[model samples]
Target: MGEAAENLNYDCNYNMFLAKIMLSNLSRPEDRQKAVKWMKKLATCNRSIEEMKLRNDFMYYLVVNIQQGELQPPFTDNPPTSPLPNIANLLPGGIAEVETNEMGEPSSTQQTKKPMLYENSPDGGAFLAAQPVPRCGAFCYLAVVAREPKHD
Candidate 1:
């Protein structure tokens, strides 16, 4: 078989191995829930897959369409409101009671710290969960080098 065909077979085997590992690890309830959540997110979220083969002009159109309603438009200034009497305690002491021209609507400044999505995600207990094979490539390469026939 040609080298290209051999490489294609190798890639298929690797992907199948990955799928098996992912499926097996999803047996636990928490893990299964996480997997379901991620699958749903993948299905609904805005995923941008840009193929490098596309021409620049075509890519521009693809990007423009994706961004059609996503961007936020600019904001304009609002009119001022009447001053509140006896509200000096709200401001810091000793400094002049400098008031801003913006409206007196109760502006709520909220700072929310969102929790991490994958803090306890499992180690993906798959075949590759075993020590990562040497970077030079497959296990067969090391086997070949280790079992070289000795010549007298």
Candidate 2:
């Protein structure tokens, strides 16, 4: 379904409906995994996802599907290369520590503190967990994070 969304360039409402249905009916770990893959792919489709507006149902499912992949307790792993400063002000973060070289030194620096929102794994995988569970418990819904709004 995600592939279909990608193929369609997220341009069709019917395709969004189909993808939403597939995501809504997720019942197993593998199913969630697949859904997460689709969501992540959909979120980062080279800014193409920017044009895809979502309804409430689709937004809710997007959050749910991402929450499934998010590691319990939240991500504090390999920080984004250009992470925002003062992340502790954002959420109670966690990290997936990966050794830099064989010395076991943490690769992430203080300035590039990983956002508490998500983690990147050793294999260079990002967003294994759903993100944006803010400190106040408000959600950052995937659609908002997928892309920046165009300036006009």
Candidate 3:
């Protein structure tokens, strides 16, 4: 087989191995619930194949080894927070979610509001729960800097 075909075969085998480990661990109720959750998340995601593979590998390790503090969730930097006044009710309908960042503080009694569809990012691309579409954006700001740049 050619190099690409060989690599594809290897990738398929690795993914199948990961899936086997994950499925075998699902005999427990908690593990089964978690597996279902991650499967749903993986299904809805628009991440690249490499990213999905990495997550599956982590999930496989999490299932087989069950390490402490290994898979710290990236979302919910919200400190053990009280819910926004009416937001809890809206959650069932998927209409509202809490907004949090360094600048904006969430208040327990804050009025209900629709979460912004998108927000500013450090890269100015997309919000936290989103996979940033690799964009070839303008680099005009770089022109103002006086530093010499390196080419890899």
Best candidate (score: lDDT): 2
lDDT of 3 by residue, 1-152 (tens): 35544444454456445554556544455554554455444333224455444444433443443222222231112211321122232223332345545555665565764444323334433333464433234322222436778989
Off by over 4 Å in 2: 1-14, 47-152
Ranked candidates, highest TM-score first: 3, 2, 1
> What residue pairs are clashing in model 3?
none
What is the per-residue lDDT of model 1 for residues 89-133, given as tens digits with 9 covering 90 to 100? 322331134433356433346333333422332433332336466
- Give the range where candidate 1 is weakest over 10 consecutive residues by summed lDDT: 71-80
Candidate 1 accuracy as TM-score: 0.20
Scanning candidate 3 in windows of ten residues, the lowest lDDT window is 75-84
How do these models rank on lDDT, best leading? 2, 3, 1
Error of 3 at 41 (Å): 1.9
Which candidate should be chosen as best, given TM-score against the real structure? 3
TM-score computed on alpha carbons, candidate 2: 0.21
- Please report how far candidate 2 places residue 96 from its true position, in Å: 36
lDDT of 2 by residue, 1-152 (tens): 46644544534434445555665455556555655554444444343333343322233344544446442221222222331223223233323333354565556554554655443454332553444444224554332335778999
RMSD to true structure for each model, in Å: 22.9, 19.6, 14.4
